[model samples]
Target: MLHYSRTCGTFTGMKANGTDVRPWLAALVIGVTGIAFGACDRRGADDEQVAAVEVAASWRSIAEGVRGDRIRRDAEMLADDAMAGREAGTEGFDLAASFVAERFAALGLAPLSDGSYLQEVELFWTRLLPESARITLQAGDTEIDLTIREDFVRSGGFGPGEERVDAEVVFAGHGIAAPEYEHDDFAGIDPAGVILVVLSGAPPHFETDLRAYYSSSTVKQTEAASRGALGLLVVRTPVDQRRRPWDRYLPGVGRTDMEWVDSGGVPFGGYPELAGSAVLSQGAAERLFELAGRDLSELFVHHGAGETGSFPLGVSAVLERSSDQGRTVSANVVGILAGDDPRLRDEYVVYTAHLDHLGTLDDGDDQIHNGFYDNAVGVATLLEVARAMTKLPVPPRRSILFVALTAEEKGLLGSSFFAQNPPVPIERIVANLNIDMPFLGFPIGDVEAFGVEHSTLRSSVEKAAHAAGIVLSPDSMPERVRFVRSDQFSFVQRGIPALNLKPGSISTDDSFDGPAMLADFLDNHYHRSSDAGDQPFSESGAERFARTALLTGLWVASDKDRPSWNEGDFFGEKFATGRVAPVSAP
Candidate 1:
C-alpha cells in the first residue's frame, strides 16, 4: 500500500509487517503503489517534466534559429559599404536582390516564378537639371527669385522639356474637390490659366480616408490640372514641416526620380495642363501671402478647421524647369514556400520588405546612405522569418511569398508593380505583412501594428503577440498617415488586408525609454547618412520582432478561412470588394 503525506513532498510505501522490505519486494511494491494511486505521484512528475522539457526545447529552438547575431550579420552585410546603399535600378540594388535570393534559396523556398526569383520592373528614372530650374514670384514691381533646392524645389514627373508659366496666383485653400466631404476648393473660383497655390495638408476634421486620399500630391496635382490650372505651387505649412523636416527634403533636390513604366512601354504622363509644380518653403510661401497682404497664419487656422475658401492672390508667379530623363529596369526579388494543405497551397500570405535605400548622397562626405536602420534591418528580419518558417515542424496550410521590393523610397513603385502584376493570380494573395524601419534601438516590450484594426488579420496579430508575451499597440502617430506611406499601402490599394509592424512606444519596464529612443532615431538618423551600420542596434529586440512577425504570418496562413477586411471599414469600403463584416476582437 502507498501512503502519501500532503505536507511533505515525498511518497512512501510500507509492507504489512511495518518493516523495511527486501530490495526486489520494495521495487515491486512501489510499482504496485504507483498504479494504485492512479500514477498521481510518479507518473505525474514524469509527465510534467517531459512536457516542460518539450516546451522549453521548442522555444529554445525558435530563439536559436532567429538569433540576433544572424540578423545583425545579414543587416551589416546588406548595409555594408560595398553594397553602395542598394539604390533601385542600380547595380548595388541588384546585388542586394541576389543576396536575398540566395538566402531564400538556402532556406528551402522556391522561386516565385518559373525557375526565376526575379520579377522585372520597367522604370523611368528622371532627374531635374537644377541650373535650368527656376521659379520667380512677381508681385507689382517686386520680383522675388526663388532658388532651386533652397526657397523652392521643382517637383518630379514633369515631361522632359522646358516649361514656363506666368499667371496670376490664386490661393485654393486645401486644393481638394471632394463632393462626399461637401468640400470643393475650386468652387466659385476660376483657376483657368492661373498658378494655384495650395496648402499641403487637408482639413483636420475631414474623414480619415478622405483626408489621406485627397491630401496626396498626386491627387492634388490631378485636381488642379483638371481645373485648367496653369501651374501648381504647394505651400508648406508648419504642420507639413513638422511631419517631414525641410532638411529631409533637401537631400533629394536634384536626385534621381523613379516611376513604373506602363505595360505598353510608355511612361505615365505628368499633369500636362499644369506648366509646373514646386514645393515652396514656408518662408517663400509666406512671402506670397505677404505680397497679397494676407496673413498666412490666419489662413492656416481657417483651412485646418475646415472653413477654407478660395480667392485670387493678386500676385503672379513665373516658373521654369528642365529635366534630363532616362530609363532603367529594376527587379523585385520574390520567393515562395509551398503550403502543406493541397487545397490551400495555391493561396498565399506575403511578407514584404523594401531592399532599396537612398543610394549615394551627392552632398555628404559619407556618400553611402547605408540604411541599416531604415530597411536593411527590415530585410534581414524577413530572411530570419523565412528561415524560422522553413524550420517549422509542420508546414503552414497556405503558401508564403517573400518579397524584397525595390523603389519604396521612390514612392512604393516596386510594390505597386508586384501588386498589379503578380506572379500568381491576384485573388490567391490573401494578406500582406510588411516590415519597414522597425526602430530596434531598445528591447521592445510592445509592437505597433499599422492597419491591423481594419481587418480580421488583427486576430492573428494579437494571438502572435500574446504567445510571445508582448503587447500589441495601435498606431500612435496617426497623423503621419503611416498606413499609406509604406509598401503595404500598395497591397491595401488592391483590396488585400495588409499590416506593417514596428517597435511600439510603450516599454515593458522602467529600464528603457521607448518613445524617446524612437524619437531620437527619427530626429537624428531617419533619412540621413547617419543611418549607417555603426548605429546602435538592439539585436534581441530585432529577433523578438522577427519572431512576432513570423508567428503572425504562420497563424494567418494556417487559419481555416482567409483573413478578411472589416465591413464598412474605411479601407475596405474604399478598396476591397466582397468584404466580410467585422468579427469580434480576439
Candidate 2:
C-alpha cells in the first residue's frame, strides 16, 4: 500500500509500522495502480519527472473535451432576467434550481443525497432594526454620537434579546493573536470587559493562506470574544478603501444577514459573548484615533510594516441594536458520477460552485443584480466540468460529486450546512475543488489555485495546469483574503483539501491588460446591478478554466492515495481530528 508522508505532503513507500519500504512500494504503486508517487531517488530524479510528464499527457485529451459553447449557454440561462438573480429562498431561485436539476438529469448523473438531487438546508434570516440602533463614543468629557449608514453599520443580532454594550474601547491593532507567525495583538493589553478597535485585514508579510485565516472577520470576532471582549469596532483602513470603495457598502446598510441553522434550531457561527459589533467608516475611524493621542495614518504605517502593539484608546463606546429573526429554507443541488473502481468508488472528490447571487435591490434603477461574472459563470463552468468528466475514456477511480450550493452570498451558509451534515459519511470525502467568480475578462494565460499551498493536491494541480497549457501563478491580492471568502473554506474546515482557482493577471493577447480588466470589473460591476448577462464575456477563458478544474479533480480522484495536509499545517493541526481511513485501496 502507498504511504502518506507528512513531511512533504506526498505519497511515499513506507509500512504502517513506520518501516522504510520505498524500493518495492514505488514499483507496486506504478505496476498495479498506474499512479505516480512524488518521491524520487538520489541524483537527477529523472524517473519521477517522466512519470509526471506521462500523467500530464494522459490528461490532455480529457481536458480538451470541455466545450466553450456549452458553458456560454449555461451562463446565459443562469444570468437571465427571469431568474431574478437566483437569490436563495425565492421563487426565482427555485426556478434556477429546477433548471440545474434538469441539466444534471440530462447529463446522466445520479442524485447525490437520497436520490433527490436537492439537499434541503435551513437558514436563519436576521434583519437589523435600523430605527432602534444607536452608537456613541465618550472620551473623558467629550461625547461623539455617530450617524448610522454614514458613520457606521451594524450586524444583525444573533439572539432575540436587544443587543447592547457599554464598555471601554481598546485599540487592539489588527485584533490577531497567531502564535505560529509570532504575532499577537493582545500581547500585553488586557481585553477583558472592553470593546476592541481593530483594523480590517491582516499583516502583509504572512503567507497567503495564513493571512486569509487571520483576516477573516469571523476569526477576529472569535478571538475577541474568547478574550472576554464585550464588542468590536472594525476600522476601515485607507488601503481597504482604495481596493473596495465605501459607497458600495451604502446600499447594503440595512440588508438582512443569514446563517445556517442546525437540527436544534441553533444558528451556526454565533458569538454570544460579543454583544454588539460595528464597522466604522474611514472618517469615523480617524476621529476615534484622534481622540486617543494617535493618528490613523501612523497606525496604518506601523501595521503595513508588520509591527505589533496595542494600546488602550481611553474611550468608552455604547452600542445598541435589535433584529427581527426568522427562518427560511434553501437547497444544494448535488449529483454524482460513480467511479468504476470498486475499491475506491465509495471515496469521493467533490466539486462545488455557489448558485446564489445578491438578488434584486429595492432602490437601484435596475433592481436585478444579475451576477453574470460573480457566479453565473462559475456555476456554468462547474456544469461543463461535469460534462467533460463524463466524456473521459475511463471513469476516475473515486466518485466525483458536483454540488451547486445556495446562500454563498450570505456568508457561505449552504456549503457550511452541507459540510456539517453531509449526505455520505464525512470521512469518506477526500478532496474539494470549488469554482467561484473566476474573472473571464480576457483570455486567461495563467491561473491562481488557492489553498494548494497547504495540501498534497499541489502536485495534481501543477500537472493539470501543465496539461491545459496554463501557468500557475501566486495570489495577486492576498489582502482580499479570498481563500477564506468562498465555499471551499467550509470543506477546508472539515479537514478536506480544497482548491479555488481564479484567473491570473497574464493575458494571451498583448493588446489587452488582464489585470486592468479584472480591476474594472471589480470596481464597476461586482455585486452591482451592472453585472448583467449583456456584458462582454470570454467563452474561451471559461473553457480554459473548465479544463484546468476538470483535470485537477480527475488527477486526485484517480490516485490510489488520498490528499494529505502539509506537515504541521495550521488548518490540519486544528481541524484534522477524526478517525478516517488513510487510503482508498482494499
Candidate 3:
C-alpha cells in the first residue's frame, strides 16, 4: 500500500511503514501505484486532489526527458551561421528542414504518405525592387514625388509586372465592411476606379479577435478588391505609430515576399484586381492630408471618438512597381506519433513551430539574421516536446503530429498551406498548439496564451499551467494584435481550436526585470543579426515552457470529448466548416 503527502510544496510518497521517499523516487512509485489502482470513482474532492497529484507526478517524470542542454544544443545548431537564417525556399532553409526531419526520425516518429518526413510545399516568390518603384501625388497644380522605401514601400500579394495605377484617392475609415457590426467604411463613397487610403488598424472598441481580423492587411486588401478599388494605401495613425514605429520597417526595405500555391500553380493570396498598393509613412500621409486642407490629426481624433467617416481626398496618386517573381519548393518537416487507443487514433492533436526566418541582408556588417529567439528556440522546444511525448508511459489517446513548418516569417505561408491541405482528414485534426519565440532568458513564473478565450482549449491550458506550477495570465500586449500574427492563426482560420503560448512578463526571480528583457529583444535583436544562439539563455525557463506545452497537448489528446469553440464565437462562426452552433465553453 502507498500513500501521498506534500512536504515543502513537493509531493512525496509515503510507505506503509511511514518512511518518506525521495521526490523522484516518490513520483515513480506514486505513478506506478496510481496505474495499478486504475479506474477509481471520483467520490469527492479528496479523490480529485489525489488524482491531480498523481497526474502532476507522472507529468513531472515525463518532463524530465526534455533537457535544457539538449534544447540549447538543437537551437544553436539550427541557428548556426551555416544555416543562413533558414529562410524558406533557400538552401539554408532546406538544411534546417533536414535537421528537423532527422531529429523526428531519431525519435521513431513516422513520416507522412510520401514515405518520408519532408512534405514539399509549393510557393510563389516575389521580391519587390524598391529602387524601381515610383509614387507621385497630384493635388491641383502641385505634384509631390515620394521616395521609395522612405516615404512608402510597395505591398506584396500582387503579381509580377510593371504594375501601375493612377486615379483619384478616397479616405476610407478603417476600410472594414462587417455587416454584423453594422459598420461599412465605403458607405457613402463609390470605390470604383479610385485608390482607397485607409487606416492601418480596426476600431479599438471592437472585440479582440474581431479587431485583429479587421485590422489585418489581407482582409483590408480583400475588402478593397471586392469593392472594385483601383488601388490601396495603408497609413498608420499616431497610436499605431507609437506601438510599431514606421522606421522599424526600414531594415526590411527590399525583403522577398512569397505565397503558397495550389495544385494548378495559381498563387493562393494574390489580388490581381488591385493593380497597385503601398504602405505610406506617417510623414507622407500627413503631406497628403495637408494637400487636401484637412488635418489628419483631427481625423484620428474623430476615429478615436467613434466616428467612421469617408471622403474624397481631392487628390490622386500614381503608383508603379516591378517585382522579380518565380516559383520555388520548400518542405514542412512532418512526423506523427501514432496513438495507442483504436477509438481515437485517427483523430490528431497537432503541434507546430515555424522553422524559417529572415535569410540574410544584402548590405550589413553581420549578414546573417540568426533567428535564435525568434524561432530557432521555438523549433527546439517542438523537438524537445515531441521527445518528451515519446517518453510517456502510455501514449496519448489521439495521434500527435509534430510539424516543423516553413515560411512563417513570410506571413504564415507554411501553416496556411498545411491547414488548407492537411495530411489526414481536416475534421479529424482536433487542436493546434503553437510555440514561437518563448522568453528564454528569465525565470518564467507565468505564461500568456493567445487565442484561448474563444474555445474549450482554455480549460486544458489552465489545467496544464496549474500542473506545471505556473500562472496562466492574459495577453500582455493586446494592442500588438498577436492572435493573428503566428502559425496558430492558420489553424484558427480553419475553425480548429488553437493557442500560441509564450512566457509571460511575470518572473519567479524578483531581482530580474522580465518585461525589460522582452522589450530589449523586441527592439534590439528581433530580425537583426544580434539574435544569435550564443546569447545567454535560461534552461530552466525552456524546460518549464516545454513541460507546460507537453501537458497541454497531453490533456487535450486524452480527453474523451473533442475540443470545440465557444458558442457564437466570431472565428468559429466565420471559419468553422459546416458552421453549426458551437458548444459553450466549460
Could you say which candidate leads in TM-score?
Answer: 3
- The lDDT values for all models are 0.78, 0.80, 0.81
lDDT of 2 at 238: 76
For 121-164, candidate 3 gives per-residue lDDT tens digits of: 99998877778788899999999999987798775435655677
Ten contiguous residues with the weakest lDDT in model 2: 1-10
**Candidate 2 off by > 4 Å:** 1-62, 362-364, 577-581, 584-586
Cα RMSDs, all models = 10.6, 7.8, 6.4
Clashing pairs in 2: none
245, model 3: CA deviation in Å? 2.3
Q: Model 2 reaches what TM-score against the true structure?
A: 0.87
Error of 3 at 294 (Å): 1.9
Q: Between prediction 1 and prediction 2, which has the larger TM-score?
A: 2
On lDDT, the stronger of 1 and 2 is: 2
Q: Write the per-residue lDDT of candidate 2 for residues 531-551, one digit (tens) a residue.
A: 887876776777667777887
Model 3, residue 476: distance off in Å is 1.0
- Candidate 2 shows a clash count of 0
Order the candidates by TM-score, highest first — what do you get? 3, 2, 1
